[model samples]
Target: MNAKMRNDAYSIFSEAIAAVDPAACIYRSVSKKDNELIISGEKYDLSRYDNIYAIAFGKAAISMSKAIEDVLGDSLSSGLAVTKYGFGNCLSKMQVFESNHPVPDDSSVKAGQMVHDFLEKTQASDLVIFLISGGGSALLTYPRKGITISDIARITDSLMRAGATIDELNTARKHLCSIKGGGLAKMAFPSESVSLILSDVVGDPLDVIASGPTVPDTSSFGDFNEIIERYEIGVTMGIGGLLEDGLEGVIEETPKAGDYIFEKTSHYLVGNNSLALQEAEIRASKLGYNTMVMSSSIVGEAREVAKVLAAITREERHGVSPLPLPACILAGGETTVTMKGNGSGGRCQEAALSFGIETSGLHNVLLLAAGTDGNDGTTDYAGAFADGETLERGKSIQLDAHAYLSDNNSYAYFKETGDLVKTGPTGTNVMDIYIILVDMF
Candidate 1:
């Protein structure tokens, strides 16, 4: 391994993650002044409210709640947070629940009930400070009257394996759950609420991130049906029946673009992939590398994205764009992986494997693709690293990179090559980071 170059890649990525630190993001957007609660310049009078409550969920749940609690202090009457298991923490005043991610489990139902109870008893004079981040869609959930967690899990897991986009999945989720698609915001009706969000979805679409717990949802039953048909998803948790009733005017549509339910509800994006990429750009420049922060809105299949990135690196190395030597190219966003084989890798690892294959002879360039949350898909590592010699090393070990990529088993390939990037449980979640370091040497 080229320790210096690899360390540089990790350095830039780390700086990016720090810039979107959940705690810092919360502190930047929220503050307490005299007798007022200020959020992103909007103030809600504390005098009118009997108590201020804070609740957050996602990978960033713990750090975010800590910042909120610090700002509110003793004035923070109560709070709660839900995060993926092994990421929970002990807060001074708020309760924390750890749940499953990417798929809702029974504990997710319990966490949903906890939030339900919190919102159910809220009075008109009370205020809710909500902290929403990536992964919340599964970390916090309450099924509709008859939908069980297993039902929700089956639908979600199937869609994910089928490569359904986050928006498509959230659209289906809205119809089946009572708490998604603005349902949480509705529950906080009559009480003023503000949500601080750390976006992980591509394009930062408000309604898609964490299924838009606080924002008004524009997707309807019709939209849900469209996604099901589009993705060819079967067994939609009886969402067809709900959409049928909705189309027949029996079930009320989800809160629309301009609903009174959102009158006092405010949503602010505290952190996003773009913000993280910008920070990475700054760090790379300081390290004597000519940095180009590519689009943070990158979206596509993992291997295809890898092919494009590798092509760009090839172009730069060959003077196509005439980029300066020692170039650091970075892109950020979430990518999808369709499970074609019983694979053992996530999207980032797959991308890394593809990159290694594409850059086999381009000696002197290195690439690292990793999830900011420190967990990639269902794997134990954040992501993986690759370079020109990766394929050669694999062949030396009697491993085949192309076969692994075909099987969606990139994790095993990188493991054998000792190239998996493991940063366990980073407390923040923005999106995935892809960095390519090109050196003339």
Candidate 2:
């Protein structure tokens, strides 16, 4: 392994993650002065409202809620924060509940109901502040009548395994849940509300982040049907019945543009993939590398993306690309894995394994791909590292890289090679980061 290059890669990635820390993002976006609260240049006179409540959900819920409490201090009239299991922290003025992610469970149902009940206490004179981040759709969910949590989980798993995009997955989720697709905004109607969001989706579409619980949804039941057809997702009888009811107009649609429910509601994008990439670029430059941010909206199959990245690395090495030797390239965005084998690994790990195969025997080239949230796919490792010797290292241990890649078992392969990147649960989510470093001999 090129230890210096590997260290540089980790350093640049950490700087990127720090740039989008949920607490820092919240602090930068919100503040209070006397009896007035200001957020992103909008001022709300606290004296005009009978109460001020803060509600947060997603992986960043706890850290975000803590930041809100610091800004509002004693004026915060209590709050509720729901996060993925093992990501919760104790807060002074808020109650925290840990739930499941990627799939909603019984705890998710309870959190959803709790949020609904909490919002019921809001009145026309109250103000609601919603902190939304990635994974909120699964962490805070209240299934519509006739649909059980099990049904939601089954569908979510199916869509994911089928390699559905975040937009498609969230569109389906918005229809099946009671509180997504602007339902939360409707619940707090008559009470002025503001949502501070940390976007984990490509292009930062407010309507798709956390299934747009507070923002107006551009998609409809028809869109959901199109997604199902595109992915060939098998729908259970109960879910199918609900979809039919939604299509027939027996069930109301989610709030859309120009809806009255959004009259006093505001949504702000506080943190995103671009912000993280910019910081990474700066850090890489400081490390004496010719750095460039490739793109912040990269998406598609993980293995295919890895192939392209490896090709770029070779181009840069040969002076065919813009950056010369000792160059660092960065990209950010989530990728999907079409599960073909019963293996444990996330998109980043899968990408790493594929990149390793494509760049075998190359000198002084390294790749690091990891999720900013510190959890990649279903594994504890955030991602993994790949280099010219990655395959050789595995071969010496009787490990076949091609076999592991074919089985979609990158996690196990990287584990034996000791290249898995583990950072535990980072208190923020901006999506995934990919770093490629090419060094001179």
Candidate 3:
């Protein structure tokens, strides 16, 4: 391993994560002056009607909520937030509930009910400041009364293991839940609501981030059925009845675009993966490395993406370049993992393992992949790293990288090679980041 180059790679990644800090991003985009709440470019006067409240969810919930608390101060009446377990702290004005991620749990159901009940207490003259980020779909879940947490968890696990895209997973959740797909907006209807969102979805698609709880939704029950059929998942997995009811129009659909409920709501995308990538690029350039923002919306299977990245790195190494020598290539966006084995790993670990094996003998190059949230999938690590020596290190133990990759056991492989990134929870999530360092300097 070129220790200096490897060190630089991680430093650049850290710089990217810092740029997407939810609280800092909120501080930059939101403020209060003379009873006016200025969020992004829109201004809402707090002196207009009555109560002002805030609600937050996702991995960055606490930080975002705190930022809003700082902005609203005495004007804020009360608030609530839901976040992944151990990623939150007690707040003065905001009630924090911890829940599961990548899957919903009982705590998630309670959080949903709590938020709903709180909104029920508001009147037409009230205002809600929604601080939304990623993971809200799971952290803030309230399925129709029939679908239990087990039902949602089973179906979510099925879809995820089947390699369903985030849009597809959220599509299914939106139809089944009463609190997703603009359901929260409906709850806050007649009361003006401002959502300051940090984008975790690529291209910042409003409806897909946290299932677009506070934005107008264009997805429908029909869309949900299409995904279920396409993936052939959760059919008799216990939630089939919910889908049947949805398709038969027996259940009310989630709010759609131009719905009256959205009239009182405004949404602003404060930050996203692009913001993180830009900061990483700046840091890389300052470190004297040519940098390229490869693609901010790259998505596909983890190993497949790794191959493409490795191919690019090989080209750059041999002078058939995309940017130049000593260059860092950065790409942002989340990837999917199809779990066919019993192995433990997240998308970042899977990508790193695959990339490591692919570029095993290529010197002075480092391939790093991690979640901006500092946690990936079900793993404790934020991500994984790979250098030229990654393969040799595995070979020393008679472990074949391809074998581990095949078993979807990237976590074990990286852990044994001591390449796993253990940054713990970063208190924020903007999706996954990919960094490749091709240094000849």
lDDT of each: 0.89, 0.94, 0.88
- For all predicted structures, in order, the TM-scores are 0.97, 0.99, 0.98
1-441 in candidate 2: lDDT tens per residue?
A: 999999999999999999999999998889999998888998888999888999999999998999999999999999899999999889998999999988999999999999999988899999899999999999999998999999999999999999999999999999999899999999999899999999999999999999999988999999999899888888889889988998999988999989999998998889999999999999999999998899999899999999999999889877799777689999999899999988889999999999999999899999999999999998988999999899999999999999999899999999999999999999999999999999997
Give the winner by TM-score: 2 or 3: 2
Q: State the lDDT at 253 in candidate 3.
A: 81
In candidate 1, list every pair of residues with a backbone clash: none
lDDT, candidate 3, at 385: 90
Per-residue lDDT of candidate 3, residues 280-385 (tens digit): 9999999999999998898999989998999999898888986877899999998899988889999989998888888878888898899999887788998899
**Candidate 2 residue runs with Cα over 4 Å from true position:** none
Candidate maximizing lDDT: 2
Taking the tens digit of each residue's C-alpha lDDT, what string does model 1 give over 1-441? 578889999999899989999998888888888888788888777888898899899999999999988988888899899999999989999999999998999999999999999899998888898889888989888988667788889989988998987888898788777778999999988898988899999898888888888888978888877776787877643555666787788978778778998998888888999999999999999999998888898788999999999999888878786679899999998899999987798899999999999999886889999999999989979999999888999999999888899899999999999999998998999889999999877
**What TM-score quantifies how close candidate 1 is to the native fold?**
0.97
The worst-scoring run of ten residues by lDDT in candidate 1 lies at 235-244
Regions of model 1 farther than 4 Å from truth: none
> Tell me, what's the RMSD of every candidate?
1.3, 0.8, 1.2
What's the C-alpha lDDT at position 172 in model 3?
84
> Between 2 and 3, whose lDDT is larger?
2
